[model samples]
Target: MAHTSPAAAPGAFVAASDVAALAAGAAVFGTGGGGAVHTSQVVAEQALQEHGPVPLVTVDDLGPDDLVMLMSGIGAPTVGIEMLSSRHQIDLLVREAQIAAGRPITTLMAAEIGGSNGVGPVGWAARLGLKLLDADGMGRAFPSAAMVSMNVAELPCDFAILSDVVGNVSVIKTIDLHWLERHARALTVASGSICLGAHYPMTAETARGAVVEGTVSAAIRVGHALLSAADPVQAVAAELNGAILLTGKITDLDRRTEDGFARGSVTIAGTGADRGRLQRLELQNENLVVLEDGEVLVSVPDNVTIIDAETGQAISTEMLRYGQRVAVLAWACDPIWRTPRGLELAGPAAFGYDLDYVPFKEINR
Candidate 1:
C-alpha cells in the first residue's frame, strides 16, 4: 500500500507515497463520477515509484511560452473499472498529442480534478518527465467534455488527441467544445468505452487564469486529512468545509451505461437521527442533484459526494451497491463555477435539469 508523506512546499510534489492519498481525496471531488480511482492509484504508484516525484507547479510558476496539455481518460466509470488502462496507452496518447502540439509540452494537467483523472496525470507527468500543473479544467468532474473551465473562459481548444489501448489514435481539430465532446464520445464508445487523451493545448499565459487553480494540492490535503483522522468521514467533510447532506443505505439504484456515460438515479433511506426520510440522487456520470420529495436539495456546480459512511471513501456511481451505508456531502464549488458564464456552461441547465443553483454557503449557513 502507498503511504503519504508530509505536505510539500511552494507547490505539492507527488511521490509514489502520495498516490493513495491523492486517489482517496480525488474520489471525494469525483462526486460519484470521474471514473473509479483504484486502477488509477495502482498505475500512478507504479509510475512514481519508478520515475521519482513529479514537481507540481502552479500556473504562476509557468513561463508564458510554456505549453500545457490536459491529460485524462474518457469513458464510463463502469467500463473503466473493468478495462484497466496501461502506461503504453497513455504514452501513445501523449506522444501523439505532442506531435500535434508542434512544441515541447512543458506541463501536463488534469482535465478534471475528480476521480481517476486527477490521479492519472501525476503518473503521466512522472513517466514523461514533465511538470504537473496544480490546476484542472473542472474542480470536480462533469460528464460532458464541454463542461470545462476553458470553455467557460471562452478559451479555444486547438485540438484534442485520443488513443485506445490497442494503439488506434485520432486527432480532432475543432474550436467547438460541444463538437469535441460529441466526436470524442463517439471514438471513446467505439474503443470499448475507455480511452486516454490529451487536449486543450495552450500556452501557460493562456492557462494561468483560465483553469481551476490549486485543485491538485487541495485533493492531496483532503486525502491526507482522511488518512490521519480518527473519524475519517467527519474529518474529510471538515477538511473540505462541506456538510453532511444525508446518511443512509442505498435502497434502490437504477443505472446504465449509455452514450459513454453511467446514467442513473439512486434512492437512499435516511438512517440514524434522519430515519424515515428518503432522498434521491440523479446522476449523469457525476452526481448531478440530490432531491427529496421532488424538491431539489442540492444541484450541480456545487460539489456533491456520496462516500462510504464508515471509511470516508467516495463511492463512485459505478460502484454503488444496494444496501451500502453512505453519507452524502455537499460543498461549494470554486467561485468561478458560480459566475454567470460558469453557470451557463455547467449549471443545472447545462445538465438538462430545471433548477437554480443555490450557493452552498447560503444553504449551509
Candidate 2:
C-alpha cells in the first residue's frame, strides 16, 4: 500500500503509514549511498501492518540495562538494489548478534540513518517486538564501517554478525573497527555484494552521547515536507537547513563496483539561470565531494545529495542515469563529525583525498 502525505502519527512510533515518508527523508540523508529505500519502505510497511507500529524511543527513553544493537546492510549500493536480504536472514543475523553479545537486544538502532539502512531496521524492530532507537551512529551515511560514531568513540565491538539472503551467517570477533570493516567487506563481496550486519551492541547509557540523536523523527518530518510541499527542493532545503548547490542535468557518469563499493563520478551541466557551469560529484557508495572548476563546493563529512530537480525526491548513487535532471543539495553534518577524531575517521583525507576538512559554514560563507 502506497501512502502519500498522511498526517503525522502522534508520539514516538513508526506506523505503516510513516514508512514512505521515512524512506523519502532517509534517502535525503543518504547523500546518495545507503542503498535506495524504496523496497525497504515496502517491507517495513508490511511488517508494521502485521506486527503493529514499532515503538520509536530515544536514549533517554531507554533504561540503562536495555541492550541496543546497530543493524544495517553492508555492501555496494549498486549491488544492494539487486540482491536483497530476506526477513528470515535478518532474524537469524539479529539473533546471532544478540547471542554473541550475551544479552537479548531490547532495542534496534540504525547504524546509519540514511537510505535503506534507515528504513530496513523498522521492519526488524516491529517483527521482533523490539523498540527502535531514534538515534543512529552516523547522522548520515558513510562508505566504511570505521566511519561510525561507535568507532570514533573507541567503543569495542566484541563481535560482528553478518548474513546473506541465502542463510549463510558469519560471526567475526574483533575489537578493531578497521579490521571489522576489512573482513566484513570481504564477506559482503563474497555474498554477492549485499548482506545484513549487526554490531556495536551497547546499553542506552553508553549510546546516549555516542550516537546522533533525534534523526529518526527528523527524517520523518523531512519526508512529510517533501511529500506535501509544492516545491520539494525548497521544502527539503529548509527542512534540513541545507542549500541547493546546483541544478542541472547529469551529462556523464562513470560507475563500477570495486573493493565492495560503488565507486564513480558524475558530471552535471548546469541549467536555468546558472547556465554554462559544470559540477562534478565524486562517489563511493555516497556522494563524497562536489567540485566546480577544481574548487571544492562540498566534501565529507558534509552531506552531498542529489535529488530529482522537479520532484524533490532523492536519487540514490546506484540510480544515477545520464540526462536525468537533478539538484545537488548539501548540509553540514553533525558537530561531532567535525571533531579531530571524527575527521580522522570520515574526513576527505580518510577517503584518500589530500585535503584538510572544511566546515560547511566556511564553504557556504
lDDT of 2 by residue, 1-365 (tens): 00111222345789999999999999999999999999999899999999999988877778867999999999998988777787699789988887898878999999999999999999999999999988888999998888898777777887889999999999998659989999999999888989899998889667757888778888999999999999999999999889999999999999999988999999999999768999999999999989999999899999999999999999999999999999999998988888888999999999999977789879999
Candidate 2: worst-modelled 10 consecutive residues by lDDT: 1-10
TM-score of each: 0.96, 0.96
Candidate 2 residues lying further than 4 Å off, grouped into runs, are 1-11
Candidate 1 lDDT, 82-201, residue by residue in tens: 888764888788788889988888899999989999999998899999999888899889888899988888898999998988889999987599999999999999999999889999
lDDT top scorer: 2
RMSD of each: 3.8, 4.2
Model 2 Cα shift for residue 73 (angstroms): 0.3
lDDT (CA) for every model shown?
Answer: 0.88, 0.89
* Model 1 ranges off by over 4 Å: 1-8
